[model samples]
Target: MRFFRAAYAVAWKDVLLELRRKETFTAMFFFSLLVLLMFNFTLNLDRTQVLSLAPGLLWLAITFTGVLGLGKGFLAERENECMDGLILSPVPRGAIFLG
Candidate 1:
């Protein structure tokens, strides 16, 4: 219960910050668009090939976008030097890692 609370707090902080600044949102939007465009243009797949490759391509986009989101969050925290503060907090390290 306490663990979840702390994690929620941390996650909420990120969410609020993102809502205020929208850096992560904007970056993620463009990143995903670029990824999809790249995949669409580079892959000239027919219906049969599409069935074989679509799942992997979908996962690739998901993974890339997820990575970009995490990177943006870390970058924001690093710029503000908030990461050290998080490390020193009483919250579980796993919560911080996750949030």
Candidate 2:
């Protein structure tokens, strides 16, 4: 329960920060859109070929966007020195990891 609580707190903090800034959200949105558009334009596949490849392309877009978003979040924390505070907190290391 304590671990969950700490994780929740950290998640909530991140949510609030994201809501305020929207930096990660905006970047991920644009990047994913650009990727999709680029794929659509560059692929000369027929309908059947496109259908077969759609799922893989979708996952690729999602994976890249997720990487970008997470990278931005970590960079923000590092820039603000919040990671040090998190490390110094009384929460267990596992809880912090979960967070």
Q: How accurate locally is residue 57 in candidate 2, as Cα lDDT from 0 to 100?
A: 98
Q: List the residue pairs that clash in candidate 1.
A: none
lDDT of 2 by residue, 5-88 (tens): 999899899888888887678888999999988999999899999999999999999999999988888889999999899999
Alpha carbon lDDT at 25, candidate 2? 88
Lowest summed-lDDT stretch of 10 residues in model 2? 15-24
Point to the candidate with the largest lDDT.
2
Residue 75 C-alpha lDDT in model 1:
86
lDDT of 2: 0.90
What candidate 2 gets wrong by more than 4 Å, as runs, is none
**Cα lDDT for residue 97, model 2?**
77
User: What lDDT tens digits, residue by residue, belong to model 1 across residues 25-66?
Assistant: 888888888997899899897889988888888889889999
Model 1 residue 96 lDDT?
82
